[model samples]
Target: MKAKIFNSEIPFYELLNNDLSGGEIFTVKSEGLKMTEIEMGDYPEYSEFVDTDAFRDILRAEREKLRYGDSKTVRISSFNINKSKGVLEVGFHPSSYSVYKAFNAIKHYPPQIFYRDAGHGLYEEGTSDWLDTGITGNLIRANHCGTGLFIDCAGPGGVRVIVGMRPNREIIDTHRLFRTYSASGSIDLDDLTPFEGVLREAREEINFEADASQIELVSFGYDSQLGYFQFSFYHRSELSFEEIVTGAKGAKDANEYTSLDPVAFSAENIDRTVRDIAEAPWEPSALWTLVVLVARLILSDGAKKGEKSGVTAARIDDFRNKLEKEIKNRNYESNFKIFN
Candidate 1:
């Protein structure tokens, strides 16, 4: 339930690995992404926020009224994409969702006793590093798994991407409802790689278990508002749109979304769909996932990218490029803000 705080779009994302290694490199080895344990108690800043009288009161109040899941989260420590090896690697440590929330409140909320560098200080002081600004700014920077679950199916016209409509915010434990891309959630403590987390999230949210070969890396981005690195992916499914929705009724996290929408895999539809989500209440990671997924559809050869190309392969770079083209072609503005 990491909702957007204000009216502005948080920040634009940076690409880690632009495209796949030669072919669309989906690695068989899980070792590419590694994780080590962390002791959150050892971080003094964490203790400060958790121990704060006002913050504790706020947490207690929120807990009494709304639903909050304080599960163990994964934080990226080091990230690298080994193009030559046809794999992407990430090193991360364990964290809790509650810790992430505390960090968020410290940065965005006002009048908290242990408020570090709160509002203006965060923007003005830090360049690339958040440590230059707030008390637990570094901790805030590396938090949660903003994983997207895209369930793709073949349609009469062509491939159609399934989008989800979440009714009550309680489903995601968020502030507002959304028509976000299929599904998006965090990773568990047991997860080793981002793909694994995506799969798990998909299974829970939509009751769809995907094959390893069918899964493709759509894009890697950072959500500065939530302050965590997000990895978005899509799983090509043999199921029809109806079958997929039917299966979703039996999902473990079926309440996460009330219904799913299938959109034609086209540029105009992508633009329209994003505008709908953006104009309403939606999360940053989900919006970016849809942007990148549509970028794969319009900018690249095909949905799955390994076919020898007279058709140029799509790079992760295409996400921003697509947005830029949308902005200019549509006579919009500076960034990929909420609307055009």
Candidate 2:
């Protein structure tokens, strides 16, 4: 399948490309939506297996912590985007995905992709025969997913930059540069809407608190490699680049990353800027988020404060055109197809 993609090397598969015509937004909370309950015994097939015991033994704080806080997560059974109504309906269930399941899902798929230099050039793909939907693993719920946000700062004198992070060496995707914030669907963060969950995480990650007014939904994608679903967003920050960095020390997740990585953004050379960012050792999911957002920012002409981001079919077509060329220019294009 020539899956819709930003690049073949990247596992991100663009599923629903909703460009809201009027900078509109949608929300998915624990209430007022379609949800179900799925137990572990539902699918017993073990085409791919993960040794929970061995994963626990790894000397990683993040991995070990999840075991204790076994919280419920949102399992995305299905989803739909009604452009006309500006509605995003997410069909999910209460599921639990601890480190055991996350490890099983991203072992080779993300480890090697993000840490290109460290990877041994070998890994596996897909959790089970779950290519049709999301991957549900044996020991964990790999189908349980999260959201990623690409936040940019509007610094002094219109000095705008894309914010990224160099993760701490002990985390899951150790020391790789990634998006500004990540809202994993857990007991407290399980919301499909861009504003609720992502804003919550951003506050914790960088001591920056933002509401729906400054964010926009870029796209929704499924990572075939790990059987993961990712919601992407483009967020604008009013704080200067320097102020944003200093505030991180005050945040609860201050130790989460070693430092921040910001890429200068200008519409004149955005294609080149994104290509350059792609060259860094990056978490594939974050890179995937960057791939879709740069185009939107360029067309939007710098995100405005106190305003919601909107998308239209015509705008999407333009962004897709630029993205296709960006991927093809690198000769990194392969199976995944987006914008089609």
Q: Mind giving the per-residue lDDT tens digits that candidate 1 earns over 1-340?
A: 1112122233534343233323343332344444445455556564465566876775665445435546777765555555566566555667667655554555656544444454323222342344222133234243456677667785555556555556446556544344565766777777666677778887888888775456766656566645666776777678888787888897888876667777555544555544443344345566555554554554454445454443333343343444434434553333334431
Stretches > 4 Å off in candidate 2: 1-9, 18-68, 99-141, 172-194, 298-340
State the TM-score for model 2: 0.62
For candidate 2, the C-alpha RMSD (Å) to the true structure equals 8.5
Candidate 2 lDDT over 108-161, as tens digits, reads 353533222211111223322333343333323345566666668865477677
lDDT, candidates in the order shown: 0.55, 0.51
Candidate 2 at residue 316, lDDT?
A: 42
How accurate locally is residue 290 in candidate 2, as Cα lDDT from 0 to 100? Answer: 59
